[model samples]
Target: MSAPTPQPTALTLHQASRVLEVGFDDGAVFRIPFELMRVYSPSAEVQGHGPGQETLQTGKRDVGISQIELVGHYAVQPSFTDGHDTGLFTWGLLYKLGSEQAELWSRYEQRLAEAGVTRDTPMPAKTGGACASH
Candidate 1:
């Protein structure tokens, strides 16, 4: 098997609009939105560890990123205002999202529609979780 690729050392996060501007060492850049990140979280709490265990995320339409904490040297943990930070987005995962953002976003929207969930609002302030460990 081939060796794993390296993570980007030049990661920029713009917290104003809750977006992550990730730049790779190879001159690649991707801007990820908070909504997208929350909806596609890889955590078991959000994505679940097994099949048929996915928990659909909703009411994050207006959620903004509170912080982007780097976990070690490989992944980033984004903390959302809605109190979600379980998903640790690794370099490879970020690259995948950057490459297929459009397709992934479309798929997510479709799936949400099929599930009858609408991310149209933010959760109450009391509802919070470990979205970032920094």
Candidate 2:
């Protein structure tokens, strides 16, 4: 039989540290940064409609979470200070983000370099079918 996915045992929001601390029943704890969460949001607004259509997030070094609303029993929806609140972070997603932070950060930096921009660079105005206002 397949093993059941780990469920969250605790969740804490550290506003000052700008991280969400999540503990799982499987004895794993993750402190996911707000900036990282915003940059890697799974929303269509950030992820776009398909592969190669991701909207690179920049100038989010200080992004903050204003609120986090629990969704049913499976996820949490965070409202960012930048006005982004569409991404529903499932337990699995959060766990992945926490476990892969180092690699994700390296990839983010590489993408920034490839785009000829730095992390501090302000994001350009978004324009497209799904994101016409940003």
Candidate 3:
């Protein structure tokens, strides 16, 4: 027998501009901004496993992406300025994070507050990606 395809209850693109509003079957909606997602990629260029290992990204608060290339059907390849062109985003991880965006965002905000880190003044750019916004 053919496997059942997981169907989403609600999924539609916003007609406003260049944004996508994704909704899951669980009545959860996540409106992810394109610029935000681009800046906060979770590749090795941004996150390096532990504290003091992360690379702070700069010039990305309002910076939009030049392009988003899909790396197969499961993940997407994101490129950035300052010549950063690595990092792969899988569909599973995206879905998981998008599902818990609200809670995760709050926790991230709290952590940043504790660290006295502001999104406006991002730390010096390093080797890893910038805190994996996706």
Residue 126 lDDT (model 3):
49
Candidate 1 Cα misplacement greater than 4 A, ranges:
121-134
Q: Write candidate 1's Cα lDDT for 1-134 as tens digits.
A: 97676569677767777677888877788898877888888887787667877777778767788788889878888888877877899999888888789998888788778977666733334445533443
Candidate 3 lDDT over 1-134, as tens digits, reads 96432333443444344343556555666666544454456766567667667554444455444556777555666554444567675655555556666775676566567767765665553455445665
Itemize residue pairs with steric clashes in candidate 1: 84-131, 85-131
Candidate number with greatest lDDT:
2
User: What ranges in model 2 sit over 4 Å off?
Assistant: 131-134
What is candidate 1's CA lDDT for residue 45?
Answer: 78
**lDDT (Cα, 0-100) at 110 in candidate 3:** 68
Please provide TM-scores, in order, for all candidate models, with all chains considered together. Answer: 0.81, 0.92, 0.60
For model 2, the local distance difference test gives 0.92
Alpha-carbon deviation at 109 in model 1, angstroms: 1.1
Clashing pairs in 3: 40-133, 44-128, 45-128, 45-129, 46-128, 46-129, 46-130
- Which digits, one per residue and each the tens of the lDDT, describe model 2 over residues 1-134? 96776899999999999999999999999999999999999998889878999999999998999999999998999999999999999988998898899999999999999999999999888666666665
